[model samples]
Target: MFIALIALAVFFDFFDLMLSGSVTAALLTSGWSTRELNVVFLSVTGLGGIISNLVAGALADRFGRRRVFRGALLLVGLGTLACAAAPRMEFLIGARFIASLGMAAVPGVGLTLMNELLPVAVRGRWVSASGVISTSSLFAAALAGYLLLPWGGWHWMFIIPGAGCLVLYCLTAVLPESPRWLATRGRHEAARQALSKMHIDEDGPLLALNTLERSGEAPVDRLFTKALVKPLVLGVVLAVGFNVATTGFLTWLPMLLLERHLSISNTLAYNLMMSLGIPLGGLACTMLADRISRKAGIIGAAVTALLLAAAFPFTSGYALIGTGFVLQVSMGVLSTLIMGLYLAELYPTNVRARATALSMATVRLVMVFLPFLLLTLLNVAGVVGVMAVVVICLLVIVFAMFLLGIETSGKSLDRI
Candidate 1:
């Protein structure tokens, strides 16, 4: 039930995230927004994410995961409700900015909570399984857009996920705090109680806590130390690379398809079809999570995705959809490996949430300016130009993984 709730929370979080692509396209077709205004919308969302990631990470580490987790859901739910009622593009943009705060933190904090709660032996598989469930939201958002946007029902897209998140907020009241986090904070009894609630034996975590480094330094400060600096940089690079490739591609794909002379409904249909690969990719990750090295999975997926993306501009109709499906599958693998597993495992319990936040903040930071780059490329060199940028980002991931990738597969969190 705990895993199920965490998965559901992540599902809504990603539903809102993926819904933006179709909503932006709808706004464009409805004459409610321009390309430039869309850029502002996306940038503001990123900026809000930047602020939320840092703040939520520190708060989760200090107060408790359940507090920050529930608070983030309430914020996102309220912000998305405001989005559903927005009458103007500007108001919608403002609402998105507010929602982005909670959206940015939900998946990361949830992953952290899951990592700290689950046993080390099955951690990778369960985390990847949750990712499988969450990835389905990509398809859900696309289907919602396909069904609703054609009939001027774009508002309902925001309303559904918004309501879902708020309901999850209430449901999460029974969620326990991370026992590992509690132990690291010197709350051994609380940690034991949390473990009991999960039906997990408390002896292992309580014993591990005795060996944990109880430093007085700030969590953020510890990120800069020599032992951690390398992992920190690698984490940021992987995150930035993944975000640039996937977010940039997914956000712009519908518009790019529209520019290719496809009708709005057809474009959405193709998007929906391509989105089918996401959950499949997650399933693949769940199978490979413990069986393969993290570096190998990330590098292999990046190379395959890069090749598939390169084929995107050369294809049309079913061919385009085929290329995108394969590309999304590859991306799903990267998402589960990087966001679901790797980033949380890199740091110790003492600073896990904060470290993950700092790494993920780069996603928002790059996004703040990514629209400008993509737009400029789209204007200058067309779809091919924008894809060229994506290719470059994927290539970087491939190289970085080979050079700096730390193998965390099958390792206990405390040992890592």
Candidate 2:
């Protein structure tokens, strides 16, 4: 079941990861100005992702993780197909947004569900294991774009994920609702049955008991209350900052390389190198997050990202390309480390899904504006100048960590 759930999580995420990159090159060639469309697409995709996050999280809390999880995959499939058949830029933008909604749920609900299923002993490890899943999705997207583009064009991108999602929907019938969620809603008997079936021991009862111990009435307000003011702000602001720095850097990487005289094929190869770095980073973070601090992992990653953003425009030839690859690898790990652990740590099981969804939504919102805004900034000041600004932004993230962020390396969601 753990393996099956992980597979499901990875499959859906792979589909989402490729949507933007696969279409990116094609968009540049579609006679539409890639710059403007990228801005619109990034904005719409991020906005849509957040909306889906909220919808999926709330619905999972209300309906059950299995139901919403399966539904999200179905939506991703349909949305991908929508992208494949979209005729105009407007239609493509809308389709991407729809896809964002579906993609958004896999993180918020899927992570929450997985954490609930696993024991604390291996929770951080298991969560970090999703890094491999994310890495595979990213790699597969790159392979699909590299191989299929010459044959069927860009539509194959969406078609493949759509097909995969259809298969996932069929397989989803066997997955159980999250036991924690069931217990939280007072379905103790049902929750116990589910746990027993999975051979899970009743370690500390469930979240319901924890809630009872904390607040005799309810913690309904804790999700948005003063006690959690720090976490709430930290989650949104960190996500926004990270997305801006990462996306702004990645979206313009190839162009920056091109400016330094690398060919298209060379740039693609460089990108593949960067993609390889993501999982390695995730693995490192997974190992360290449980031992050190989640906040430290984020800070380390951001600082590295800042340095890489600066280095890309200065070096040339193999050094420049090598540095780009290294930067990407670190950024990928940092992103997964922070997003997977930190965001999940910010909310309880009851509002975990909602809190995560909102954080994801904020990232998407940043994506919408950052891509366009950064590009314009680049046009005005060239690649070096643009990266200098990003360095400052990344510095701000480090400062935020010291001020607002809490350590959640080995903490449980209920306590966090």
Top candidate on TM-score is 1
| Count of backbone collisions within predicted model 2 | 3
User: Whole-model Cα lDDT per candidate?
Assistant: 0.88, 0.70
Supply the TM-score for candidate 1.
0.98
lDDT of 2: 0.70
lDDT of candidate 2 over 27-107, digit per residue (tens): 664554466786687678777776787678777766787789888888888887898898777888888888777877876
Question: Which digits, one per residue and each the tens of the lDDT, describe model 1 over residues 246-304?
Answer: 87688788888887889898989999999999999999999989898888998999999
In model 1, state the lDDT of residue 297: 92
Q: Over all chains combined, what TM-score does candidate 2 have?
A: 0.90
- Model 1 misplaced stretches (Cα beyond 4 Å): 210-212, 216-219
Q: List runs of model 2 lying over 4 Å from the truth.
A: 30-33, 150-152, 212-221, 258-261
Query: For model 1, what is the error of residue 166's alpha carbon versus the real structure, in angstroms, after optimal superposition?
Result: 0.2
- Assess every candidate by TM-score: 0.98, 0.90
